[model samples]
Target: MSIENPQPLSINSMAALVTLGKFLEEDQWFPQLLENKRIYRVTYSGKNGQFVCFAQIMNKTSIIMCMEETYESKVQW
Candidate 1:
């Protein structure tokens, strides 16, 4: 059987994930988090309508890597 390896996360990306996880845990929303294929997407809204940060969670590690922004806003604040 072939083994698949998980990607390593950058320092900034890992930190952001930890922070986001903590916030979600405190808010009791962490359980609702889901992994969509290789990317973990969370529905969030800011000053704009809606946005999502696509991330990959490393297996057997606490690292989370931000891949790319799934949504873009044409309206400039």
Candidate 2:
């Protein structure tokens, strides 16, 4: 799905997106969402513990909607 009014991503989210974008730029293999817009799942470790980041890639830009999973639920990408 296309973003209607894509807002500015948070500082942390922007940093994560930038890191993933760099990786995608180097490999040229960004994640492609099936039936949905292109999506990417980035896993990282922090002070708290391990975490997963989910984002949507559009026009070479990554839009992160949510951070770590709050509860057990199947992610549609």
Candidate 3:
């Protein structure tokens, strides 16, 4: 759904558009987002409790808003 029709999503729409992996071009935005206070390091809870990742935070929101997750993350490229 996300690839075919990328648009604003809502519960009333019956589903949401989500991406599995982002493109390399998108990584360019991360640094600026960090400087703008829109993204930061997060524990990114996992089975082993030994992971760290970055999350884009919504304006005037709490970090706890993110759900518990386990991602096969890559820290250094």
lDDT per prediction?
0.51, 0.56, 0.35
Instruction: Report how far residue 60 has shifted in candidate 3, in Å.
Output: 15
**The best candidate in terms of lDDT:** 2
Give the TM-scores of the predictions, in the order they appear: 0.36, 0.35, 0.23
Best candidate, TM-score-wise?
1
Question: Candidates ranked by TM-score, best first?
Answer: 1, 2, 3
Better of 2 and 3 by TM-score: 2
Task: Kindly list the per-residue Cα lDDT of model 3 for residues 1-77, writing each as its tens digit.
Answer: 33334333343322111121132125532222244333444443334455455554332332323444544573333
**Candidate 1 residue 53 C-alpha distance from true site, Å:** 12
Better of 1 and 3 by TM-score: 1
Better of 1 and 2 by lDDT: 2
Off by over 4 Å in 1: 1-3, 32-77
Which ranges of candidate 2 are over 4 A from the true structure?
A: 1-20, 23-37, 58-62, 69-77
What RMSD, rounded to one decimal, does every model reach?
6.9, 10.2, 12.9
Candidate 3 residue-pair clash tally: 0
Which digits, one per residue and each the tens of the lDDT, describe model 2 over residues 11-73?
666566567767755775444333332457556655455676666744545467657654435
